[model samples]
Target chain A: MAELTYREALNRALDEEMARDPKVFLMGEEVGEYDGAYKVSKGLLGKYGARRVRDTPISELGFTGLGVGAALAGLRPVVEWMTHNFALLALDQVVNNAAKMRQMSGGQLKVPIVFRGPNGPAEFLAAQHSQALASYWAHVPGLKVVAPATPADAYGLLKSAIRDDNPVVVLESEMMYAWKGEVPEEEFLVPLGKARLAREGRDLSLVTFSKPIKAVMEAAELLRAKGIEADVVDLRSIRPLDEESLYASVRKTGRCVVVDESWPVASVGSHVAWLVSHNCFDLLDAPVELVSGEDVPMPYNHSLELAAQPSADKILGAARRVLYREDI
Target chain B: MAKTAKNGRNTLPPREILFPLLETMQLIRAFEEKSGQMYGLRKIGGFCHLYTGQEAVATGAISVLDLSRDYVLTAYRDHGHALACGMEPAPLMAELFGKLTGSSRGKGGSMHFFSAEKHLLGGNGIVGAQIPIATGVALAQAYEDSGGATLCFFGDGAFHQGALHESFNLAKIWNLPIVYIVENNQWGMGTSWKKVSAQSDFVATAAAYSMKGLVCDGMDVLNVRDVVGEAVEEARKGNPVFVEARTYRYKGHSMSDPQKYRSRDEVDEYRRRDPIVFLRSRMEEAGLIGEEDWEAIVQRTEGLVEEAVRFAETSPEPSLGELYADILA
Candidate 1:
């Protein structure tokens, strides 16, 4: 079990998937010769050649649409946007075509495509670059939205996403790329819509995904020291949301706190909270508490940005408020 | 320039195919007229754009292709394209009625007709959205070694969309098997072509992508057939071809359109050279069919359309449970 950073795990997944299937390839801005804007696709162009590992002009709409075409034509294309913020330029292809093609074609055409890149708040990137829109994709019906928190999960989920016969959005966090964890060397794929119980407990269930999972785990440990055992659930996939696991954990704990980096109104946290109230209402001991990012746009200042997002302290405070029978 | 129409008889297609083209044109006209009446009675909701004067563009373009192997995709004004591609009139009418028997299982309405078995990708609602998708289908055919070409149909309004340019460049650079047909109708909604575009010539736009472009009189079915036939052959040879079919729409843009932009005389001017009249007159002069035979064909088309409406009226609306279906794998 060697320790690999989240960036390295994603690179290894792409390398292995490409080596396994000739039809599998990578395409995007700076993905080929430039070794990826985040250095996640380094050395791939040298190994795979330009045809298999193509670098494209800085036309997001053009390249993304090309990738969709390539995928429809029998190639499994791994398309990377420089950042999720840049995805707005290609929203027509991603939302209008990629998501709706399979159903619109009456299950005749399968868009086996993957749109991956770093998502969520990156420090000093200001409002344009530093925003979390995972919930925006999760709100759609046909597309699969995934945000894996750990390095191993990043590798496993990406492999699964490439193999999926439907469109999948793999959102990675830019700030979490260097964070390291143990990853197996052999081939493995984690299924979509499955949640992982990162840290099991009984007092309060802390549910989150992507980068916030780490913060939730940290807060869970801090709460454990204060004699409050919190169960930490990492939601790997958000679209085919693992409601079964979420409800089971909520039913067992009788209290829940959802943490998300997106805003509170119409957010993933609100949806999860709604699901809990709708499906697991009888199991609730107190009202479900939610710790979400502030509704305001992300500020450029370091302190302001940090305060805008959900943190371990904020989650811990939310958990205590639920435990203390306070309005949450 | 090289005198490629050597077999003038072949260039003028046999009476057998010509009669079929006439039938298709009449069917489109009658179908759109009936659909217009339906839309007035509060039957079909949402956007109801008609392709009344553009029937020759679809009928002529689809005539030269092998429907079994080739794929066809088009923009929102797609009823003619769908019928020309061999979709049964019943399912199409049912689709407009929001019945489960429709091509899209009643979910797509008129703008999203899809038939996988016949290789009709979709009647996409968004402008210029199918350009890249059709190019992708062509790329897929090339990847699978299927020896098929994809025909992408859009309108003059779609040329303004940036995606069309992107699709044109990539299709040319990759040498994908695709024929990009731009039906240059004079209006996009209420805006006229001359008003919106500085250069109204769409064929020159194709040259910017280093693709061969041909412009044909969309009001003449025979001219459109010959041009599209050559373009389809060129596309099959792994060269993407672009053809601009300069047509007009006799009806309003959609059901809700007031058509306050153009005068009634402009509509009558286009109606004078209607494709149906051109085909029938040519057939009568050539002794291909008698006047009585042409009348019978019109009667048969109207009967078929009436039968389709009856089928659609009897068809069931999709259950609410269907909302959860076809949304995932």
Candidate 2:
């Protein structure tokens, strides 16, 4: 195993996939020569040349739809949006065309395309830019959504997404790009719809995905200090959610607290809370708590922005409430 | 009517080559006439847009394509384009009937017919959504160095969309192998182009991107064929061309359209120059086809449309299990 940053792992995934498949090409604004806005595609331009690592105009709807078209025409395209904030401009293409092409066309076509970029709240970049729209993608039917938190997962899941025969959205985090982790030297694929048991404990289930995994892991340590072990379920894929693992963990712990960076209303966290509440209705010690972002626009102030998002302290509070140990 | 083609050709194509163009146009005409009748009889439901008077635009442009490799896409007024690309009429009718044997297995209705084998990407539902998708398809054609071109069709209504501008810019800068054909049917639904567009000349819109721009009498099959033929060659050389086919749709935008915006006299004027009649007359004047040949062509198309209706009526609705299928890989 070798240590690599999240950005390096994603770059490795892109490099490996493009090298493996001649049909694979990368397209986005500043992806070539500029080496990508986040440098997640560093050195791809030199390695693959302009035809493969293409730099596009600031046209998200056009390029995203073009990527879908390329996929329909038998080319695997990885179209990068500089950020998910800008992806909103191309939502019509993502939601209308990419999400519905397969089923709408009666399975005649497969949109083997990946729309990858940094997502979720980062420091100082407030309101429009600091939004985590994972639920928006997860809500769609034909599309698959994956938010990888670790360097290993960033590598494996991205490779898997590129190889996937359906349109997949890879939700990378700007904040986690510099975070380093050990990844396998040899090729590996962490299959979608599978949850990683980050910490196996029995007191309560702490479920989360994406950047919140770090805070939740830290919260798990805080719980361990209080002589209360918790089961941490990191949902790598959001759309084909690993419900079986979540249910299993919730059933074992008999309590659950979901940590999501997106706002509460109609969000992935709410859906998970509902699933646990409905399916595991009988197997609960206390109500399933949801620790989500504030149901308001992200404030520009650093302190307010941090408060708007779910933190380790917030997660710990939710876990304690779910475990009936709030006094502790 | 020995008309010279716009490609500087002394004469049009040979009788064998020209006969299929008329045949395909007739087939599209017959298919659409039947589809309108079916919609009236309550056999078809939802948004059923008929391609009545604009048959030549689809036939003329599509005839030049090598369908084995080339891609065809269009807006919802797509049955003609689908039929022109050699998609069987029965499945298309079955799609309108929402049957299991439909091209999209009844999932995609009138607005969404697709055939992977024919390289007909889709009859997209949105106004100008196909432009970027078609541009991307051309991106593939260029990346693979395939000697193929993509024909993307949209209406005058799609001109105002930002997708059109963005797609054209990319097509020009990337030098993708795509031909964008605007079927300027004079109206964008109920609203006339005069009321909507700041620039009425659809061909001039291509100049904004520095792309090759061409125009054709969409009512004339030979003119369309010549212009689109030239554009296809230019596209294959990685120069995207935009062609404005000045045509008219005889029917309402959809079955539900009142068409109160235009007078019956205006419809009559365009009808007098019907593409089907124009092509048949050209063929007859050139002594290429006799009255018997025209009769035979009509009979064949009518027979195909009749068989399609029968097949669609007989085909069962999609099974309950199919509802949950095809949403993912």
True contacts kept of each: 0.49, 0.86
Q: What is the lDDT of residue B74 in candidate 1?
A: 95
lDDT of 1 by residue, B196-278 (tens): 89775778877787888888888888888888888888888778988888899998888888889999999999999898898
Question: Per-residue lDDT tens digits of candidate 2, residues B1-329?
Answer: 11223553346679888899999999999999999999999999999999999999999999889998899999999999999999999999999999999999999999999999999988899899989999999999999998999999999999899999999999999999999999999989999998988986777878788988899889988889998998999899999999999999999999999999999999999999999998788777778899999999999999999999999999999999998998897
lDDT of each: 0.86, 0.92
- Model 2 chain B: weakest 10-residue lDDT segment is B1-10
Candidate 1: residue B237 lDDT (0-100): 77
How does chain A of candidate 1 score by TM-score against the true chain A?
0.97
Give the local distance difference test score of model 1. 0.86
lDDT for each residue of candidate 2 in A1-328, tens digit (9 for 90 to 100): 9999999999999999999999999999999999999999999999999999999999999999899899999999999999999999899898999999899889888899999999999999879899999998999888999999999999999999999999999999999999999999999998977888999999999999999999999998988888989899999999899999999998898999999999999999999999999999999999999999999999999999999999999998898788777664
Candidate 1, position B196, lDDT:
83
